[model samples]
Each structure stands twice: as C-alpha cells, then as structure tokens.
Target: MKNLLNSVVGHQAVIDRLTSLVTTNRLPNTLILSGAKSIGKYKTALGLGQNIFCKSKVGASACGVCGSCLRVKNEQHESLQILKSNDGLIKVDQAREVTHFLSKQNNVGEYKVVIIDGAEYMNSQSANALLKTLEEPPENCFIILVSSSLYKLLPTIRSRAQIFRFGSLTTGQLKQIKPVDDWLIELSGANLEIMEKLQDSSNQEIYMKLASSVSQLSESNYDACVKQITSFTKNKQHSLVLIQALQSLIHASYKKSLGMSMQKIDWQEPALERLSALTQSQIMELFTESVKFEYYQKSNFDILLIFESLFLKLISYFNGEAHHASMDRYSYTP
Candidate 1:
C-alpha cells in the first residue's frame, strides 16, 4: 500500500479512503473510478486490487513480495481481467463474455477483479449486458469501471456502483513530483502523465513550425497562414500536433493577459505576446474553435475547407472583426 500510494503523483485523499475501506473489509463490490484522462484513476484501481489480493499483507498494506503481489504487479494474475474497447466501442458480446467469466468461481485467487478501461465506450447494448452482472455481482468479485466522462455511463450501472472521483494536481502539487514547466502543466490541465509525456516527446520541430504560423497570423498575413495550415493538414497526425501547439500558445497568452508571467519558452514569448492583443474572451473563443476543428478533422470533414475556415476565423479575430463562423453543424465529406 505504501509503495502503491507513492507511485501515483496526486490524489492522496482517494488513496487514504480506499486504504481505510480495505482495512475495514467494506470495500464496494462495484466501483466507478471516474476522472479526467491520465489522472490516475486506472492506477488507483490497480493499486487497490494489488493490496486486496496480497496474501501476506502487513498492517493494511501489500507485502509486495508475495506470490499474489508479484502476479498483480506483473499483470499476470489469472483472477484479474481487463476489458477495453475494440475500434471505438465495447460490443455486447465482450460484455457478455465478462459476465460469464464472473459467474465462475475464483480458483486461482480469492477475488475476481474486472477493470473496464474505457467504460464509457460500452454502447447501450453492451451496457445493458453488463448491467445484469452488476445487479447481482458474484461474491468475492469486484468491478472497477474507469472513465473520463461519467455521464456517458448508463444510469442503472452507475447507481449500483460506488463512484469515486479523481482530480488533477494543482501547480504546487505537480512541482513536488517533477520539475515540469508551469506552462506545460497548465497545457495538460494538470494531468501529470500527459505533462510528463509531452515533456519527453520530440515536439520541438512542430512547436517551431507552429510558432512560425503564429508569427504569420501576427503579421496579418492571412494567405501565409492558410498556406501553412493547408500544408500541415496534409499529414493528419502532424495537424493534430499543430492544433495542440496552437492551444498551448492561446492558453499561455490568455494567462499573460491576466497579468500572469508567460510560461512558455523565451523564443515563443513574442508570438504569445502578439496574441495577447485580443481580450481573454476572444482568445478563449479562438481556442475553442480550434478544438472543434480538430474534432471535425477526425470525423473525416473536408480538410481544405476546415483549415481555410480556421485561418479565416483567426484572421478576423486579429483584425478586430467579429466573424461568426457557424459551428452549430459540421458538414462531413470524404
């Protein structure tokens, strides 16, 4: 338990609560671990399972060296089952198979633990199949549903499970774990996993490219902005990275406009400063539109028009013109 708690960055309150529940032998059979992506809900579930299955526990903690502990650590435990979506949804057949798996007695371990990784991806048909099992969960069996969005889950399934909400770390809390840049942390919305990954990844080239595009926008070079974005959208993966880079710049500038010191690298500060020309609300609108365009891009929207529309919106905002681009509906094209 001590090691497990230490491995996770933040959310000590949830850990303490789960620890207490385990010690009291009153942990819920079905638990909904709901929180933002990369916020440690899945890790918490794994830790809780490890502690519970550890045969030689010492004072409300896992021994870490026991056979059960080793299996859980290596994810080789027979009693532990992990369910994930295929393509985009967890089909009804998969949910039914899990129900069948739970029906059997646990011969290898004392408890049967099932973790639905993207619980929200369970469509209505699959959710109903799983709901039957939740209604009458087998003894010594545990179900941990992990989701970033809880509202997507069926109400009946949620009602039977004890929901535990996880939260992101604050700036001060994040600093305790690693020396992550404050701006990067804000960009990740305080998700430590995402912040660390972004830090380690080689995004410098794309960041520089994105910076140049922003410079063009600052110069009121609408044609250049369109050309740059059009070239970027050619590679879907690169285009997504550009959108993220834009979001980071917008966020940094928004913070600076509110009297906060800019958190990005020194070179990027100039472009961010130029973006500070717009009010906080206008900056927010632009960021929101960029996010929408990214989503539309994923759904196979017309790439040329999407980037062109985005460039036009940014040009209008910078020129002090209120351009209302109707995002009420997206026109899909192959």
Candidate 2:
C-alpha cells in the first residue's frame, strides 16, 4: 500500500511510533511535536491526521488517494483544524476559536485534530484559555502542538501532552526530499524552510552579497555592512532569511574554528574563514546578539535601528572594543 506516512522525509522512528498508537486506537488526546524549525513536525502531524481520518486505510496509514486523504492534503478537510501564528503570536482569540472548534461535534470523521504550528507563539493568556480543553478534551479529539521552542510553552500544557522531540534531517534525507545544490542544503542547516528560501535566485543573490560583506567586515568597512543589510531588511521576510543565513554562517565558522571540516563553498569560504578568526567567546557573543536581533525582528521592532545597532557591535568586535551596549533596551515581554 502507498502510505501517506512514507511521504514525510525523515523521522522514521516517530512515524512508526505514531502509526502503532493510531492502529491500536491508543493515540493520546494531546501531543507536543517539539523540534528545531522546518524539520517537518507539522507534516508529521498532517500525516497522522490523514491516517486517523483515512477512509480507505489498508493498514496503519492513509491510502493517499482517497477523498479524505486528498482533502487533508489540500487542507480542506472538515475535521482537521490547523492554527498558525499571526504577527508571531497565537493570541487568546485564536485559542477561543480552538475551544469552540473542539466543542462542536466531530461531524466529518472519527476524530477532530487541531495542529498548532509554532505552538510556542501562544501567549500566556492564550495558553491559559486552551488549558481546559487540553485537560479535558472531548472524546475522539486530538490536539497536536508543533513548536521549535518547547521551553516557551506553559508547563501545564506540556504536562498534559505527550512530547516527541525531532532532530535535523541528514544531507541524504534532505536531498531525497529536494535535490538542490549541496551548498544550498548545507546553508539551510538541513532545514527545509531555509532551503526553500535559498532556492529563489534573488534570495541567493542577497545571501551572496551579505556573506561577502560580512566576511570582509572590519572597523573601517562596517558601514558598508549596514547599508547592504538594511537595503534588504525593509522586507520583513527578507530580513528573517538574512538573519538565518548569518546565523548559519556563524555556526559553520565556529565549527571550522574547532577543527571541524566544513564543505567548502567558493562564495562562502572567505566569510567563513574571516569569522573563524574570532575567539570562541567572541563567536558566542556574535551568536548571542544574532539571536536577540532575530527575536526583536519577529517581535515587530524597528528593523533599521536594530540592524544598524547590530553592525555597530560587529565593528566593535573587530576593533577589539568590548561590546557594552545593553540589550534590555530592545527587550519586550514577548
């Protein structure tokens, strides 16, 4: 039988475990699929939904061509509810909607499945609003919380669910899913979302330019880095891609400094070599700032100011000046 679960790229162990639970009808009411971003946790949730609602299941998997399977594939299924974040948050109103959704009868299938992608985006109020549902879910209802940041979820919510951790896909597995250039795959850190972003020619161009600027960065040329990055940061999505790309470079450089062999990409080697010169502590500082910059970007901070500030600190690192700027000024509760 052509199984829908077979379509998911990696995480075979998770698939097998889920298949057993579904086949035995012992699947939990609440599940937490925790992992790094873009490693296909949501896809696994969808595959599980398909198997649960599959009308023509041969064994423990969906037929992938039945009416129920197609609807789920198209995200048009009546029983499968997928909630994604808006403006980087799943607010209380969305939580109320989920409660309302599960409250109603399961008219279309044996179960009502709610998959919240980026589950950590749920604020305290929203998480509290959904706690009752999590604690006492209606019979035949399944809620799958998909998150890259498991620590951010409320303990009560985590306590009520079965947690499954996912890891990054391997190069071979990534290639099987999408046969892109090897450098592109490495740049994505085996993450599907970043790989997709790098597929665009324009994004590739921006990545090269950014990589070159950062690789050659010095105290005197730091302003050039700001100009290059700010030009693309005007688009929020582009800014995110740029930040992730920078982080990838930093990670690769740190590994190289530790005597790890990285696949040598012509365009990126110069930057990697440049970054590898920093001490381990310096590398960590850059990484820490990058993470904070990413958080601010997602939280709707002033993009231009943050980008400029980030470059200023970058220059200080090269100039041998201690980075003393307080990040609390840009911090928000979210």
Which number leads on TM-score? 1
Q: Model 2 shows how many backbone clashes? A: 0
Q: Over the stretch 140-200, how does candidate 2's per-residue lDDT look in tens digits?
A: 9999999999999999999999999887789998888788888887787778778898889
What are the lDDT figures for the candidates, one per model? 0.76, 0.83
Error of 1 at 126 (Å): 3.3
Question: Which candidate number would show the highest lDDT if scored against the true structure?
Answer: 2
In Å, residue 146's CA in model 1 sits off its true spot by 1.9
Please give the RMSD to the true structure for each candidate, in Å.
4.0, 4.5
- Candidate 1, which ten residues in sequence have the lowest lDDT sum? 325-334
lDDT per residue (tens digit) for residues 1-334 in model 1: 3445458778988888988998898899999989878667787888887888887888888777778877876777888888889997999998988999899866664788888988999999999998878988998899999999899898998999999988877788678767877767766656665576567455545666666667677335767766765665677776666667777777777777888754457667667756766877888877777678677768756666766665666666777877655631332222
Angstrom error at residue 278, model 1 = 1.1
TM-score of 2: 0.77
